[model samples]
Target: MEKVILASRNKGKLKEIQAILEKFGMETISRDDAGIPEFEVEETGTTFEENSLLKAQAILDEAHTITIADDSGLEVDALEGAPGVYSARFAGENCTFEDNNRKLLKELEGVPEEKRGAAFVSVITMLFPDGRKLVARGECRGTILTEIHGTEGFGYDPLFLPEGENRSFAEMAPEEKNRISHRARALEKLEDMIREKCSC
Candidate 1:
């Protein structure tokens, strides 16, 4: 199987990516597990695509192999798409998920359901040592609930209710979420591109 280094330490994310890429005959491993030297890859980009590419290039430079990186976040329409690139640090640096969720709820206080529209966005970038690069983007439109609803997911999953669904992401199983998540959608596109290039 082809090996690819994932430029992230989040185990959940690694698992998700692994499941998606497995069928493509790709083996995904975290940067730590791949024995890559740890160096801060600062997210200085203003957009998800830029940040994803930055991280992918940083790892590709170090490992000289195919590397994948993703920049994803929850975008609340009412917030004017705020917490975009800053999603990870929305509640200040090193803040917990609860802290960020609390802040989001507070920000949308008094906002009706109709205006609570939001979307989860994922931008995945794959960079090869030979200077080839591929980028894919996916989005899941949903609404922000009045309060957190489930306990199974991380970040803002508990508060996000996808369109045509009654349960929040946190309420669904990993398989269920992966089947319809923004990351999954992005990976699906990436898979299609790969298939087209390889004529598989």
Candidate 2:
């Protein structure tokens, strides 16, 4: 089995990636497991793809190995893609998930159901120590609920629904969501790329 480095400090993200890649028997090792020092990868870029590349390249520089980095966020149509790149700190610096979700709901209070269309966008960038790189993106489109729902998942999962699904992302179990999430779609694309172009 080939080991890949997922350059993220968030444990939730690590678990999510692990579950998604497990389909291909790809195992991921985070900095926590590898005992590598973690550092801030400033998201100076304005797009998820750019930020994903930034993190993957930074980690590859240090580890000099194959690495995968993800950058994702909720993009509300009404907000003109707000909280896209700024998803982590939408409320402000040091913001909590609730803080961001609350502000988003407050802004969409009067919007009609149809107008609340939103989607989760994810970009994954892979960097190989040999100076090769690949990027893939995926999205799940749906409307923003008037309020939060469910008790699973993280970030904006509670309010965002996938098309044709009555429940929010947060309501779905990890296994269920992993099968259809924006991250899952992107990972599937990444897996295809790995097999076709970067197979070890």
Best-fitting candidate, scored by TM-score: 1
Candidate 2 residue-wise lDDT, 15-94, digit = tens: 76777567667788896676667578888999999999999988887787778899999899999998899988999999
Cand. 2 Cα-lDDT = 0.86
Tell me each candidate's TM-score. 0.92, 0.88
As a whole number from 0 to 100, the lDDT of residue 108 in candidate 1 is 97
Which 10-residue window of candidate 1 scores lowest in summed lDDT?
191-200
The TM-score that candidate 1 achieves is 0.92
Number of the predicted model whose lDDT against the real structure is largest: 1
Candidate 2 has its poorest 10 consecutive residues by lDDT at 16-25
User: Per-residue lDDT tens digits of candidate 1, residues 102-174?
Assistant: 9999999999999999999999998877767789899999999999999997999999999999999999998
> Residue 73 deviation, candidate 2, in Å?
0.6
